[model samples]
Target: SRGRGFGRGRDRFFSSDYYPYPHRPGYPWAPTLSREDEVRMLKSEADALKRSQKEIERRLGELEKEE
Candidate 1:
């Protein structure tokens, strides 16, 4: 029967902002940045992550040597 679990309909799907569909008409559906800008941003983030990982590894090495 049409209770709390059955036949709730499609209204629930579009209620959240995280839904895949656009919330309103004429909204920009794609990234505004150019391909080069996106690539540069990603590369910078990756480099920062790599540097942090290297620092962690170095600290671990020092701790192991002390033990």
Candidate 2:
């Protein structure tokens, strides 16, 4: 049937748009760690990055002032 074919084609197109990673053995679909661990790790990394960025900006300002 023409209508059935079009419906299948539309479903296929929409399904293709939502591409998911291929499932593999021993792979988790989501984070396995507790929320606290995740938040702590993220915050630690973010704070370190922020400190590094501030240091870079301070050095740049010093260079500009010297020029």
Candidate 3:
């Protein structure tokens, strides 16, 4: 019967063509970077954040003055 076929498929767990790869037991791959590169990226991000904060504060001050 069709019900028997469906039950067998469910038991085997092999119905679809899509299958996932088995995970390897180990630490994930992470890239290593030099200290100079890390510091440059951090400083650039800090400068951008500082600029955005200053702009936000200026807008808030303008809104306060208008109130």
Candidate 4:
């Protein structure tokens, strides 16, 4: 243990997820999620999906070039 954080015992982060519900166990259907939170979450998910799709497309293109 020394300088700043991330010393000896601070080797890893918590196993528990900060984003609750759907992503984590026992969260269940949260009908109380605010409209703003829902919108933000949806936007983030969409962005993630778009990125994944792009990555898949790029890999497919590379594979096609190989063949």
Off by over 4 Å in 2: 1-31
Q: Weakest 10 consecutive residues, lDDT, candidate 4?
A: 8-17
Whole-model lDDT, model 2: 0.74
Model 3 TM-score, 2 decimals:
0.55
lDDT of 2 by residue, 1-67 (tens): 3332355554433452434557424645885879999999999999999999999999999999999
| lDDT (10s digit) by residue, model 4, range 1-67 | 3333355443245332354446555646757779999999999999999999999999999999999
Q: Is candidate 2 or candidate 3 better by lDDT?
A: 3
In the range 1-67, model 3's lDDT, one tens digit per residue, is: 3433365553244443334456435688989879999999999999999999999999999999999
For model 1, the local distance difference test gives: 0.73
Model 4 misplaced regions, further than 4 Å: 1-31
By lDDT, the best candidate is 3
On a 0 to 100 scale, what is the lDDT of residue 14 in model 4?
A: 35
- lDDT at 65 for candidate 4? 100
| lDDT over C-alpha atoms for residue 62 of model 4 | 100
lDDT by residue for model 1 (1-67), tens: 3233235443444342344555455656886889999999999999999999999999999999999
Candidate 1 residue pairs in backbone clash: none
**Model 4's TM-score against the true structure:** 0.55
